[model samples]
Target: MDHQEMADVESQNLETPPDVFLKGKHQVTLKFDDVVYKIKTKKGGLLAKKRETVVKEILKGVTGVVEPGEMLAMLGPSGSGKTTLLTALGGRLGGKLHGSITYNGEAFSNDMKRNTGFVTQDDVLYPHLTVLETLVFTALLRLPKSVTKEKKVEHAKGVIDQLGLTMCKDSIVGSPYLRGVSGGERKRVSIAQELLINPSLLFLDEPTSGLDSTTAQRIVSTLWELACGGRTVVMTIHQPSSRLYYMFHKVLLLSEGNTLYFGKGSEAIEYFSNFGYAPSLAMNPSDFLLDLANGIYTDEFNADHTIDKQKLISVCKVNCVAQSKPALKGIYDSGKDQNRLQEKDSEKWPTNWGQQFLVLLRRDVKERRHESFSVLRVCQVLVVALISGLLWYKSDISHLQDQIGLLFFISGFWGFFPLFQAIFTFPQELTMLQKERSSGMYRLSSYFMSRVVADLPMELVLPTIFLFITYWMAGLKANVVNFMYTLLSLLLNVLTAQGLGLALGACVMDQKAATTLASVIMLCFLLAGGFYVQHVPNFIAWIKYISISYYTYQLFIGSQYSYGETYPCLTGQCSIVEFPSIKQIGVHFGLHDQLMAALGLLIMLIVYRLIAYIALMRIGVTKN
Candidate 1:
């Protein structure tokens, strides 16, 4: 295979610096040792997509200490692997890590993650909550009992002030589909949330990226304030303005997963050119480093740390090989278990599971609160139900075959409308969930369960409204048999619609694609859903099994007045009564298609839930 193909196959390990790529299993730690990193792609066809590489090896000798009251600003060109470094520092890297990373001399692991805070590029806030509300909610969960609600509120307010967001404190934080704060304010809210727990160290990936110059400056200043307050802050930046560059206490510059410089931000120029690129001169420091560290300009400044960009990159990669650090010095005899306070972290149940669930549950409940758009969904279900019912009114029994055919459509519409709303709006919630889960604030199960619960009320309320309104208006036959059948049919319809939505979402990632894919799935299932049309050979029968429509279709037709009954539209002689009986309409004595439909619906619900969770968990553990 060609280099790019090889890159595609081993993409995860490729972009890492040769140094980091060399770290063996035993030396792995959050700390960079002989570890090198690069910004390589797994395999996406085009070379342009690969962008840039970070460290090749994590130089083992570098101290893991990011002391409080200090700032480590990662500076390099767009492809310099700045963000990769920050993620690696937070222990969220893609593959096996190298070297040991100790948090106050304690080995860093998943347990330590609870105490660490990370702010991603996107500001993943619930657009519903105001600035103050978002921070307060996070604070309530992260703060200890020693801090009362009053103090939590105070703490939130203080974080807002510290981040320079007092002016927009009460502003809503999302968009038109909802309502909310500005992008910059939202970013600060994300940062403020991470700060609520008062973690000694904070890591942010491209915190100022995509922001206006003024906004970027303001954000950096906020970080400077935190660092000044004795919090260790490390962040990656792509061409920070001169003013922003001055805010950093230390700067680590990388190129092709190689370290160009690591030390004081002010020392960057002297360290590079002094090692012998430019004889002596002053230039925009971030630009100078970028041109040297990464091939920012193709034809210009062509050697390692030289005035030429591409050449500088090549030269830097050649000579800047990560120097291997000496092995551990102190406590060499200590066993691995000595580093862990518990025998097996998972073996011990959390002392207060209720509290953990409660904290996550509150967020979920609040997020599902109805927004203005919810009206659109209410109107939809209402429209389909009443309109379809009116059309299928209590008609004649001689027209049994026609009415049964109409029954299939009725069940389809009942299920279809809800499916539409979910395909469109539900994916948006998943994006927010992905972000929250990334921060390690809540588990996927907690969010998923809350969503299922919140949706139950929505699903039931809207369908119930539609059913009752439509049922009365159309005046379908009324008997215990019909009523029970109708109720089960409605419930089954909702369950199936929801399951389909969940499944579609799990399979597709993009919103537009998800919508399109869901439409296709719904269409295919409905077409092959049942024996509504002539059953083809055995080949197509399996399609029936996969068909959500078949079950809802069969259930709806088989539901009520199965034998025969006299009925009127209550509006016209337009009704039908086949003579009271219990066998022709398909209803058998003591036999309930409703129960069968219920079981079928339950099976779909479970199967869909299982598939969705599997897809979701994989999504959880993996992100592009």
Candidate 2:
């Protein structure tokens, strides 16, 4: 059956909410008039002398209206601007937009944006979150405070049931790194996440791009059911099966950012037949339309044995205008409603800052707990530490070179571990973070702070373990006060390295790039760490000031040798030696007090974190 008959059938089957729940909720008519959108992008390579900015038009004079309870499918070939138009209508597109978009005969406002939901082409979900947990978190953050927790959960369950995800409700929504649900199920979970908000208008981009025919049909059927429930729906779709094509109540055809067809899905074939572009009985109507939009036609339509794409497109546009003018005029000329209510500019974040921080912290902890305890990671650190300890094997102070070598090893180990650990912080989750941030779930600061808070305890665990194994095994400092001071300094040093990693990750939002940059920086720091090179040229000596390893090594050296005096040399003569004295290391790398080195490490921690925060804020939300 066609979507109109199916919509009628599903409307009767849909369970209606209570009158109180529907008090201020009503379906809205979404209309866009003479819409035009373009983006200015710069073009140049790194070595180019000057960059040129050019405006690329995405949509041009697109005018249409989607009435309440209708499912509109935007179909086009690649680069036909289908996704751009969808984003523009949803108010999520960032560009030069020249048009008026209205809902229920009123201008679009923040209230409308808050009530509308846009699902991106990609599924930006947390792989560790169960479907139920993900939906619950979304509801808690997006639903108004007036909604009780129980009712919100009930609503989430209703949405889950509607999306046919009851069986996998408790399963994790996994990604490429982990396996959980099938592609179709994951797509439904994405839809279900948006449905948790009960939006009046839902926009989806290529929801069935990768699914099988049956799965795609089921997804489209679910969307039809939503529209049948008095919600307006619009989606960008590619080649669809005949059965799925018929599931859309309205079909909009776009070619080169211009409208080619805007009418009932059933009438689309008839509308194109007038231009001598008839589809065979076996042909999928959706495919036929896309072929025409892409300037593909049979010999009959091009009897001259030559086809001019621009000419065909122009002819089709003229014919479409002539045929669709009356229907288009009726929709746009409809008078405004006199009783439209005043819209309040709703705040993007529904919860206060403190609440957002707490919720995010809890969620992050749940998501990362397994990784924090991964056996491979734990064994990796322990094995590395064990090997290093065995190599050093408790050297005596008389062997000053070995003792100094052990100190440098400690500095390098702690410095590299924390930096590597934190490099993946922003790059790995950039997509998910941007999606959540765009939805206005929380402030960027809350997420950054929550990550910092959630990561500390886990970050501290491995380093402490590594230090305990290596400290006495290498026998650097034997006294109680010295050991405690060394341990504290190492912990602070780890934190400082983590801050550096975070800053680098935020500045460069690619994992490979950040890792490569971290490696380079870590190597530079090691070279200037005072133990490797006792003397250096003044030109690059400033690297020592920025190196966490320099301070860590200095403090460790001071802590170990503060009480030692002269020691017997291998030549059988007593040599005056200030073994661990910072004053004796070399004037360029010397520190008067271990406290100053520890304090310098603390300052680096705060400074790097601040840089990360600024970089994250500047990175802002990922736009596409």
Candidate 3:
């Protein structure tokens, strides 16, 4: 291709509407066949047992030629499968996906994520960062190297203005505990974050679901404006008001996994009327659409509940002309039909895994830095060290043994922190990450590595400072003995604990359950740490080896219990030199033996990370 020809192709690609996916010269189709889902238990065991399919064996097909620059609003009732159909189109649906969905003449892949942006119901904004930072970071992760930083900033600003968020541009986004922007503003910020890449297509799920009537209308208006700018927007809207109904240029109506109508909003009213229901002057169009869709509560609109199911069946029979059923019956037995992917041999896939991996890693690192939880953690750890160290103030060595227990408690407790944070934070963030992952923004490894890398600096620096302040203030050991020993203990605690966190985060889908599980595990480790309890009995003794705190404690106690050390023996009431006897029992190799006990804990960390990685990959980085 010549330079001008290539430029024209690039321009066409850049201008491709989000809704009107360009598929070759003019052929376009939105088809779905027997998209069925069966609910399973927490243990991967089928409870509904192929019975109670979340979505029945229904078929939906829409073949309307949506123009390149238009807004297609999918309006329906709650359980009418609007979101499900959208999920399917976005390439993020669950269950046995038997149908084929193609975009721009190619099936959606993880690689296409850079071109697609999905805005979810939940907003996963860092509470500490201003709006600009969040969007900038998102663009950094998803945009190409060709897009310059200045261009990136301009894009973010344009998205902000397009979304009508200029007033709150400099403000911090509000979260559960923090007070910053409003709900509607936060939602816009989420949209703005994805808009940085200037995606060809944008998929939004209930963008106005939680907001008030006015706010929802404003958001929809902004989306409409984006459509005017030549972006393709397909959103799932549930029960929109009469005033909000006119914003859509295109309307896709689905009922019970069946396509009722897929065309202009004006034609939708006529289509419903053909089935014997007319939109009343006083009635809301959205409510009318839903009433016909749900097959219930249509007295105000038409008093004809029978019209819904009848229309549904009629539409399904017409749209879903699937002559043959899916080759597989149950989802469990329907192993991934990856054979279809083999046809893509001719596609120019970016095969550079190494380059992609690096790109993903850098993006993840950026995200990790935005996590204020770790920053708060660093501050808290430092504060605790300073306050505790200064309070002890180089006092007598009377409380030496108790102090040793305290040291163990610190090491063990801090080690458990990452676990708590991941379980609580990760599941919640799963809402946002799931959207990004589905849209193909980045890889799982990139996210995992980025988070781990970002946390390393804070984790190492905080504990090291804590150890120094506490060691010197407690007047334990002064020379290199104190510095090296404490540093090593802190390092082990951080790594092992973070590994546990990742494992728990991946294992438990529910935040509450994961938190409870980690708490119990921490308590067990605390006991096995040999602080309050004397020794780990043979039956429970294995826990001592597995517990990270056990190793750090033993090392601290053995290292601190030296000849020149002056502290109270066991009872906590003795001067440094007044203790009966303070002696170092372990030589250099003995010290090695003591530290070696933590090897099990380190191994557990590795095992946990591996398991977490496997779990994340299997179900995907999104919610289970």
Question: For each candidate, what is the lDDT?
Answer: 0.62, 0.78, 0.64
Cα lDDT tens digits, model 3, 275-297, are 56665544666777777777754
Best by TM-score: 2
Q: Which candidate do you rate higher for TM-score, 2 or 3?
A: 2
- TM per prediction: 0.77, 0.88, 0.75
lDDT of 1 at 376: 75
**Candidate order by lDDT, highest to lowest?**
2, 3, 1
Residue 189's C-alpha lDDT in candidate 1? 84
lDDT of 1: 0.62
Cα error, residue 325 of model 1, in Å, equals 5.4
Q: For residues 1-624, what per-residue lDDT tens digits would candidate 1 score against the true structure?
A: 332233244333222222221111122122344354433344444556574544334332233234456788877666556676677777677664555655444555544555568888877777777788788878766665556779888988988887889999888787646666777777888898987766656898888877899999888877877666656688888888876776777777776555666666665565555445442334466876776665432223443332444454444444432322222222232335333322244422222345546665676566666542377767876777777777877654555555666666767776676676556444676666666555555556655666666566677777677767666555555656775677677777777788777767776656789778777877887777653445346776577666767666656655555434444444543322232222222333235655665677788888877777677777654331
Worst 10 residues of 3 by lDDT: 323-332
Residue pairs in collision within model 3: 18-201, 18-232, 19-232, 113-440, 397-567, 397-568, 398-568, 419-501, 566-576
